[model samples]
Target: MTWETVPLRSVARVDAVHVAPEAISTSDVYVGLEHIGRNGAIDETYYPAAREIKSSKNRFDGRHILYGKLRPNLAKVARPRERGVCSTDIYPILPGSSVDRAYLAHFLLSPEAVGFAAARTAGVNLPRVSWSALGELPIPLPPLAEQRRIAAILDEADALRLTAICRLRLFQKLEESAFELVLSVSR
Candidate 1:
């Protein structure tokens, strides 16, 4: 299949719905850059209630793909599982009808995209990728079905990698325990 390359703005838009602190509900979940893990994962435990937030925040639903504009090299991205408010530092991207949220999220996490954002970041301290710059990023577009298939494959690979890392950590812990046991017995 021939994939067409287009600017990210052509396939998605940044939903800049900033809700004032007073308008935000206490029960609303709030995600900050720290709440997002590198490469499209969310640190579910870190989200705070909106009541604790003092500034205006962007509102997003599960359909939006959250991209951390600050420190884009970290590739902090995620598909929110529920409606929530996020730091203005994050761009809540809403994929166009032709685009798939998962596919778009994976693409944004790609090395090319991360490099693009990193290179374009502005500011001496706390550098950030502006919405205009992010919107200009080139994206490879495939057929909807192909995009879904590709996303599924990538998801499976990511899952396998995580499992392997978990297993490796468990083995390391076991080794440490065995070494301590041997030392204690010798003593």
Candidate 2:
């Protein structure tokens, strides 16, 4: 399908939620930028009780896309299913009518979008892309129907890739254990 390229701002609201730390309850769900995995996996282990957070954070709901604006090369993006507060470094983007949330998240994680964000980042050690720059990113927008189709296809691929990575890690661990056993037996 033919897609029309448009600036990200045209189809999404970047960092739409900005609230003070005190504004949120300590018991609320918290998502740090580090909690966002490179493979669109939200690190469930990183959720600290809202009271544990000392600084301000962005609030997002199920409808928004959580994007790691800091160190964009990591390509961290996810659509959280719950309402909660997230690290200020992450932008809680809301997609417009023409764009689907899943589609936007996948696009943000794509190599083209990631590279575009990386090129616009500022700072040498801990670079971050500003909301303005992120909003200006060029996105190839397809029809809503086509976008859903693309997103579904990408999601399936991502799930398979994650499964393979997990299996590989498990195998490596088993190999290490076997090698250790062999060395102990020889000793």
Candidate 3:
């Protein structure tokens, strides 16, 4: 039997959410809306740490896909590194190693999943994506090798984009410095 497509709940366990503290600390690693990128990469540095995070918040550390369960937040899914420690509002998805996390991440971050999550969101304030709805999400699966290959391509593209951004910023800084020096001398 080919399980080309499977419900997320089958390959994973969706935890009952534990609410985190109102604030974060350096000791506590927080996973908030900003940590995850649209491309499914987790920029850990972006997620600030607080001194303390509440225990009730979902603990997604190591090898799990981190998902922002709050409405527009669902669009920011990523696979966290250093496993364990995240904001109370962030939902952690631990994908079975058997399933390539990169592949699963792509699926979760897909437009389809975002729409699904949005439809089920409960709160009027933030349009929270319900865990049950998230769990029931159907994901497209591919073999491990294929998943890795896809991930690698995505990673390469990201690196190139970042490189270009740095170059652009550096040039801008140079221009500003030169202008400042010339203008200062003219004055």
Best-matching candidate per TM-score = 1
Using lDDT as the measure, the top candidate is 1
**What's model 1's overall lDDT?**
0.91
lDDT of 1 by residue, 1-187 (tens): 5689999999999988989998888677788988887757777776566567889999999999999999899998999998889999999999999888899999999999999999999997899999899999999999999999999999999999899999999999999999999999999
The C-alpha TM-scores of every prediction are 0.94, 0.89, 0.76
Q: By descending TM-score, how would the candidates be arranged? A: 1, 2, 3
Better candidate number, 2 or 3, judged by lDDT: 2
Runs in model 3 deviating more than 4 A are 1-3, 15-28, 37-51
Per-residue lDDT tens digits for candidate 3, residues 89-182, read: 6767777765777777777777888888887788888777767788888876767787788877876877898899899999999999999999
- Residue clash pairs of candidate 2: 26-51
Worst 10 residues of 2 by lDDT: 44-53
| TM-score result, candidate 3 | 0.76
Off by more than 4 A, model 1: none
Cα miss at 30, model 1 (Å)?
1.6
**1 or 3, greater by lDDT:** 1
129 Cα displacement, candidate 3 (Å) = 0.8
